[model samples]
Target: MTAGETLRGLLELTRPVNVIAASVLTGIGAFVAGGVTSHPVEVVAAVVATGLAVGAGNAINDYFDREIDRINQPQRAIPRGAVSPRGALLFSAALFAGAIGFALVLPRLALAIAGINLLALVAYTELFKGLPGLGNALVAYLVGSTFLFGAAAVGEIGPAAVLFLLAGVATLTREIIKDVEDLEGDREEGLRTLPIAIGERPALWVATALLVAAVLASPLPYVLEEFGAIYLAAVLPANAIMLYAAYESFSDPTAGQSRLKYGMFLAAVAFVLGRAVEVVGAA
Candidate 1:
């Protein structure tokens, strides 16, 4: 392969956007969970560890989903023959090791979160993707747990639980929408996702209900006085995004559900802004 193709393939396997999101989520978690570290070095270490672990999960997920990707995503690194399966596995292992190694030096809390989350990452890619409700639930927890994991890295974050629940509900809602969109692809692999288990309309309804739950819960931080008025600056828009996501899910637009990915990111941004304001207001 050409050098450019090789480089692109490697990056594709890691899903850099997702990795960056994980790190960003970690930072938000760390900051809200405690106050981002007093030491910038520790903050860097935490983000690096979270990013590596996220990369490890993505690489291995591609390796395992190679056959599936060959049908659904023919241009992926493995499907395009840009990277060998064994090579991908090795990359995943190296990334996982680096993540854990980096966390080991940070703090005991980081170490524990790293190890448990790594295991969950492996299980998610390997075992859970094929299951139905359980898999969807796992993905939600895994995604939302990044918040808690980030919080744990710094110190005991009192408000982290509410954040976890809010994110988790939104994630589950998003995953269900994706399942409805991927009905044919998943059927080809004989995977029993929510849409396959029930029906598309029912699944969409479930997703819409969950989205409503998220919308209702989004105001909790402000209601509880965790964040200041500045948080509303970002969160209000994010809530609007979630509201649109609910409508989209209900309408079942032909396009697959990728829009909410950014919407979730926006919500995280709100949290970060709100948390910063909270700290500043307190100080």
Candidate 2:
């Protein structure tokens, strides 16, 4: 392939946006937990490992879902013939191994986290993606792990762990909304997504409920001595925005652009708000 095509292939393999979001959440969690180590080398290694692990998961997911992508995301690298399935699979394997190797340089907890994330990725992509309900939960868990991985790297599971868990819950709600948005494509491909199995309205309701739960939970840390006023101030508005988006998603399940963009925005805000909580708490 030409250089440009190769670059695009790599980008597709890496799922750059997801990796960045994951890495940023890790950094934000670490920063908040007062866990920023002076060991730049170790931090760099841990970050790289996180990226590789996320990349590997994306690549492997593409490999396993090549046929599904053919219908839902035909222009993707594997479906569009820009990259062969075997190439993607091998690339994924390499990244997984590289991630584990780099994680080994950090504390044993980081290594263990990497290993668990890798395994979870495999399970999610290979077995859970087509299952109802479980797929959404699995993706949420993986997203949540970014924070836990960071906390583990810093050798503390304290407030960051709870924040990460909350983040995961919010993400799970978003995942359900995404499923509703893609119901037609998923049904066409025989994928048993929650929206497809339960019908869009019920699925949307579940997503909305989850979003409400997240919004309610957003301020609890600050309220119960887990965080301070700054976290409360920063996160409350963001949570309101997320709740608005989730409410809109329920009202307009077919609004694909609205769901995709706004759902993503909510997820981004969750990470930002959580980090804000951490930073304020540290202060």
Candidate 3:
């Protein structure tokens, strides 16, 4: 492979897309936590740290999952021999160390959260990953807590709590769907994932219920006056997309699960935009 190809493979092993999304989440959290005037330097550090942490987590997950990928995702970097397990392990270690180091220069809270999140990610891959709803809930809580972590960095833990709840519920819904999509591979790998534990049909039912609950709560920010019409408008379509992704997964879970990730991304965008609108209106 060319240098560029090698670079791309390494990046893919880190799941750059998810890292980017997480970086954005950190930025939004910083914004909501302190407005524009609070902790600009710290916020930047936090964002970079979050991206690194996510990359590290992804790399480690790939390292641990290489054998599984050989069967379920042969084209992945490790499975395809584009990245060695040792290389991935070292890379993950480096990223995690860098993330913690960066956060350490910020607030104590940022440092603490980064350290804890790093440990949790590692544990999730090795220990908690096989559990059914427990693993799903853990991942969802971690995703949602990114916002709180950001808020904590700025020394403000306000409305982001609600955002945490909303994001967690929605993320859990998507995670359950993903579990369904990966049921076959997980079963072969001896994983006791939610879909495998409760069967696909029941798992889908649970996932769909969570998705519906999130959709119903999507309008809460507007109702609570935490956001304005712009937020409401953007959230409407986001909720629609989430609902469709949830129900459609019942028929073709793999495809629906893929789309649901994008839907969740859209929902995140709407939240950011709504907050932006609130800021602009206030100005």
Candidate 4:
């Protein structure tokens, strides 16, 4: 392969979008904890650590899944020969090292969270990915922990707690939907995902119920005065989109999951906006 192809493949292994999103979530956590200005260095460390960790996780997952990708995702970097499995593994190891280096400078709680997350990331594809519901829960926890990691870095995790729950539940719902979307491939691979353990429709129902609970509780931040009215306004639309996506998943899991991601992104934006409004109001 050409140098350009190799570079692209390496980047693809990192799943750059996910890395960026996870870093952003970490920043949101720090911002919500009211530490962005007061603890700028720690915030940067937390965000960088989160991005590196996520990149490492994705690269390693692709490495472990190279064989499965051949059947389910032939165009993936390793399966397509754009990147070798050994190269992916090495790259992931380097990323994990960088994540640890950054995380080590943070406070005790943040370091602890990072250590657990790094271990979880390394073990996910090999140990948990095939289990029914357990894999989804692990992935969800990883996603939600970014917020707590960021908050803990600044010595305050109180505000990020609600965000963690909201994000985790939403992620769990989406993970289940994704499993339903990949039911055929997972079945061929002998994987026992939630959708495989239960029926696809039933899995979607569980996903929908979980999302509904999250939607109902989305207003808690504003109600508790953790955020301002602007947060409520912004989150309402996000909640609506998510609810609609959950409803749509029954008919088209692929589209529904895609839309659900958009909704989740919107909700994250709402958190930032809400926090910003509160800061401005106080000013």
lDDT sort, best first: 4, 3, 1, 2
Tell me model 3's lDDT, rounded to 2 decimals.
Answer: 0.82
Which 10-residue span in candidate 3 carries the lowest summed lDDT? Answer: 29-38
User: For residues 89-137, could you state the per-residue lDDT of candidate 1 as single tens digits?
Assistant: 9999999999988787666776776788898889886788777777888
The candidate scoring highest on lDDT is 4
Per-residue alpha-carbon lDDT of candidate 4 for residues 1-283, written as tens digits (9 for 90 to 100)? 9989999999999999999989988999999888899899999999999999999999999999898789879999999999999999999999999999999889999999999999999999999988899899899999989988889999888658877877888899999999999899889878899998989988999888888887888888888888888888988999888889889889999889889888888888888898888788888
Worst 10 residues of 1 by lDDT: 250-259
The number of clashing residue pairs in model 3 is 0
TM-score, candidate number 3:
0.85
lDDT (Cα, tens digit) per residue for candidate 3, span 78-163? 88877778888998999998898778877777677787888889999788887779889989988988887777777776656666
Give the clash count for each candidate. 0, 0, 0, 0
Residue pairs in candidate 1 whose N, alpha carbon or C atoms collide under 3 angstroms: none
Pick out the ten consecutive residues of candidate 2 with the lowest summed lDDT.
Answer: 256-265
Q: Which stretches of candidate 2 lie over 4 Å from their true place?
A: 2-4, 37-39, 70-74, 224-226, 254-283
Could you tell me how far off, in angstroms, the CA of residue 157 lies in candidate 3 after the best superposition?
Answer: 3.2
Best by the TM-score measure: 4
Q: Model 2, range 47-131, lDDT digits (tens) per residue?
A: 7888888999999989998997898789899988888898888989999999988888877887787888889898887788778
